[model samples]
Target: MTTSSSSPTVDHAPRDPADGRWTPRLVLILIALAWPTQLLAAGGILGANAIAGVAQAFHTTQVVWFGLTLTLVSTLLTPFVIKLGDLYGKRRVMLAMTALGALGELLAALAGSFWLVLAGRAIAGFYGPFGALSFAAVRDVFPARLVKQASGVMGSSVGLVAIVSPFLAGWLIDTWGYRGVLWFLAAATAVAFALIALLVPETPRHAFGSRLDWPGGLVLGGGLTAVVYALGQGQS
Candidate 1:
């Protein structure tokens, strides 16, 4: 008896439409978040040169120490800021960081001494919140499927900005000077901050606590400073 057997057919899942159409608002929001982050990080491209220029302005090498101090402090502060974002809202934390950075830039522009410049650098240390918290915000708002692509675009923006920031900083230094560049950066940062405040929605995800822990901030800041300083001095 020869009998022909029929095989069961497998079913496939539905796919997303490939219409190439996207919401303008979402795209614009992503661009806003990404572009400013790129600009802020790029703000550091000629950062070493800026410190040297500050050194010359003060007629001492201590300004370089100030820059290094800020870098160390900022590195230490990063985890705390991220944690804080996880506590409060990511948008609020990010806005605060951007505002602090802008304020620091403004202070640096007007600084008259190495100590004053160092203070400004220290003030600017919270800038890490932008990229990280912005990411948190994206995760809050966007679909899981799109978040990866969005993150990729944002990361690429940083690289693209890096390619241009140093040249721009160099030109600004030639044309206006370090202080001038600081002023420009400060103004631009403030504008960006304002844009974020106006446009971005606040996102509170996995943020449960109300009380901000000071001990965490201090321990994180001090420990990070020790480790990063060790590595930095090793490089030197």
Candidate 2:
């Protein structure tokens, strides 16, 4: 009569492993990694197709400023973004970049002046570190054994987007005005942001307290800026 009744053990169910695996969600995340760049490339190229329209809208032949601002600002911000991603979480930085890119696209689409468009393009620079940040994210989320395959998939997606951007740009330009390209980019970025939010888990980071060499960063940034400026000038 002295024996105490033991409490029943409640068996908890294990979480689903497939949800965290690399089969589909990871693949989609990799593709989405290139979303911002793909949209930027398509919109920049569309500017050439709609040069006359752009000039008419801005009342200036300096419409090239839009593309240049988009590209250059992003380039200049890459080091900052890389360091931020390393210090914080890559996923958080990536989401911020996508959101900024979306805001930039919307601003460009509704722009009433060339300067506003330039501002929008500059805002879009947040997307500059996407590829690098995404690669780091893949490494954080996936196992070492799967990283190679994941990287290969992400790399190939860049080529695939390049191949398809021309056609996509042409179709959008033909169907809608150049402004529509900005709208399309905004929409695409929104979708990508949603995908990332829902599908991609928070990536593990080992970068806490890691020091950044400011002097080296500045030197590298200066050198890269000069080279990029030259390339942009060549295009003009």
Best by TM-score: 1
Model 2: which ten-residue window has the lowest total lDDT? 7-16
With a 3 Å backbone cut-off (N, CA, C), the pairs that clash in candidate 1 are none
Give the worst 10-residue stretch by lDDT in candidate 1. 7-16
- My TM-score estimates for the predictions, one after another, are 0.83, 0.81
On residues 1-236, what C-alpha lDDT tens digit does candidate 1 reach at each position?
A: 99753422112112225323345556766866886678667776767557666767788945556557667767877777877776766777878888988998889888887788778878877774467677766776565677788788887777777777888888878877778678877887887788787777666546463556778877877887898788767745
For model 2, residues 1-236, the per-residue Cα lDDT tens digits are 59853532122212225644566655666666655545555555655666566777778977767677777777777787788776766778888988898898889888888888788878876765577677777776676677788777766666666677778777877788778777888888887788677666665444565777687777776678778878878865
lDDT of each: 0.71, 0.70
- Give RMSD to native, each candidate: 10.3, 8.3
Which candidate ranks first by lDDT, i.e. highest?
A: 1
Please give the lDDT score at residue 129 for candidate 1: 47
- Whole-structure CA lDDT of model 1: 0.71
